[model samples]
Target: MAQQPRYAQTPTTGGAPAALAPSASSSAATTSTKIGDRAFDKIEKTSAEFFAITYGALVRQMFIDHNERADIVNTQLDQMGERIGVRLIEEYAARSGAPPCRSPAQAADSVAKIGLKMFNPQRPSQWLQPPRSSGPVSSSTGAAIGDAANGSNGGAVYSISFDENPLNVFVELPDALRQTLWYSNVLCGVIRGGLQQVGFVTLVWYVRDVLRGDDVNEIRIQFQGKERETFKVDMQK
Candidate 1:
């Protein structure tokens, strides 16, 4: 039998229920939404069909380059995404002028509300929904980030589900590759790399894939810990 995954606990303050303060939460959401909208309007636009076709070509070439080894192609895609993400963060910071995230919850929210809007060609309203945090919700705040399954470890976990994925726009997987290839795995690496640039260490993976016959595409994100100071020094060496 497959083992179930553990999740984070709900966060709380001073014995109160785990939830964001109503007014504060609303204000923050509004501000972030506006920032996202502005950033999206300012960024350069591209033809969706062209982008999709180009990406498809890249993936197909990768398969051929790797002798049709899906696993190797997946890893290379992630690595490529990481490099892109590292550079993309610089553009994101400059263009969005958004504030830095203080918690895993905040990061998840920003990615859904801001990052996706800025980069994705789709209109903000078209996004199926914002990222969903696991665990209980407060009536006022709706569903917000909760504590980690191991609260003692001081981490959190959340998920982002999409009804539509732009990359999968013109993609159809063959039966032979369906079970082995994660068609959109680069996204997982992009998120992981982007967060790492901001000091958060995270573990990201696909929980559900639309290509795999899932109703909605979902990616799970687990906060591990902050990057150590030494990490920067080591990278410079």
Candidate 2:
């Protein structure tokens, strides 16, 4: 699980829930629908453990089911990623120079950087070092996966989590971000869509609860199928 970013801050009055005060707005009904607490409570209730475990398990199950046809699953996932990569390549070409993607690691790093930048501009992601591809990033046999002297590294898989923990979606938002996971997941869908467009057609995509019942806290992805061992990207140190 990734930690949430620093930018997400909830409004506070001396670290306490301030009493509901009438908004300065002169409209009577305007202040009446100012249900700040209600939204937060709903978000809190949504991110509960039940939602996380159930959602996580459902995604995992979907992957296994897709994997029933190992050969097709493998091709399907890579094609999906590739399809996204193709469209992304054109986008990248239009926006920036296109670097040669020669391995799975490279592809992951490229996707992460370009995807994040084209999607979110506020807090961009920094790729971790060691440039190791682990945990099913792709199911390709020839993919480069780092391994220990006595153990095996998981295949190359991209594990994405929010930068902040328990983002308060229902609380008074700071305008940096709105108070809704539903709004945030649009980024996720764009990413998922890009991947599918690139040809990782068999992936299981869904949002996960990071803050118990809040759903505002986290979004997650697990490749239900496979990816192509095509590129080696430099994870920005």
Candidate 3:
């Protein structure tokens, strides 16, 4: 018999997200192109399958085959994240004209309008900025964002929050509950793969949040504080 589809249904979970996301809305008055549950289901299944393959390979390549080495696996994941950063910059440049995203809202717009289109064609983007940035949250022109950055008191402190997670399609996976399942920082891989497909290599990709939860799907890439480096997305606003 042919194997069952991945999303025939969600596997039992500790529990599903408190609320599933609402269907997307369109501002254009004439016509709206939207992907419904069926599309989401397909993405969900593909995500789960990919996670399985990547996680298993990671374990074998890192632990059983050589011996558990945390650093090795982590470096791999981060390299992947940087690759994604590079590819995303290219896409943003093409569609959004490469701005450093003056505000959190703009960042969300970049992810939605550019990132989602290139990565998760089936899903829309939803961005939530983490409090404020330790690195001045102002326009490249150096205009202060005012009181909004008032919360910037954190002072170069590390602030952790979610970024654009296309893999949320795997939210609460089945069977894998309890131990659940995670190919930690696998987003790094996706980012790397997507970027390498094009051409860009500044920083290496990496994953910080692990098997955390669907609530905070965080991922990032860095090259030794090179985030300050000039790039297309960093172009003047």
Candidate 4:
């Protein structure tokens, strides 16, 4: 007997077979983009130049306060970003009306498409997988990069790449700070903190930074595990 096709065709009122509707993931992505655009339109505006310069000044002061200890300064920056992220995630939830992310991929999509877009507004972030062992994969910045290894013990790993970083505007790194400092390490902390707030314990770090003369800025994130909540009950005397 002859084999039949995998998907059976269904006829519509017009008598022609109906086309398949969009996939759920595709529809969800469209919805996320629309939500991000609407939220961006409603947020207060700020000058990018001003924001960059102010952040630069703050970083410089941190260098001064920490006696140019790059590691210490980096730690402090990450701490500051974590605090900001803790609050920003709440605002994002309230404004974007986005549903809770049920998986690492969904969380990554929300962060790259919605969260980052809300701040940058003009630039779009690219979610990328690392290169396979067979060959390197092309990235948004036109560089050959590989996909990150899957997180340990069934965790997930992915990268977000950016062609431009507003934080690096009007900023240059001296030779001394090149190797020791990650200028935008705060972004990694922000990702970690924001996801942590929603029950995800993630390990986030910068893999490539334009400030360090890389072709693009890439932040790698790995899902570690879910945050375990502990509550203490008091006994009345």
Best by TM-score: 4
Runs in model 2 deviating more than 4 A are: 1-89, 100-103, 124-155, 164-183, 202-219, 223-237
Ranking by TM-score: 4, 1, 3, 2
Better of 1 and 4 by lDDT: 4
lDDT of 4 at 3: 16
List the candidate 3 regions with Cα displacement exceeding 4 Å.
1-25, 28-66, 95-109, 121-210, 213-216, 219-237
lDDT of 3 at 96: 41
lDDT of 4 by residue, 1-237 (tens): 211111112223644322211112334346777777767666776766566767787888888778778889889988888887777786777667777776777778778777776776433456677543222335743321233456555567777788888777777786677767888778888888788888788878777777777887888778887764221112221
- Backbone clashes in each candidate structure, one number apiece? 8, 50, 10, 6
Best by lDDT: 4
> lDDT tens string, model 2, 1-237?
212212223345554453222224433231112222222222222322333344334333433665433334334444444455445534443443434444344444444444443323212222222224222221122222222111123333443434432222332322222222232333444455555443343232323333334332333333343455233223341
User: Which ranking of candidates, highest lDDT first?
Assistant: 4, 1, 3, 2
Which digits, one per residue and each the tens of the lDDT, describe model 1 over residues 30-83? 677777777777787665555666677788888877888888988988888777
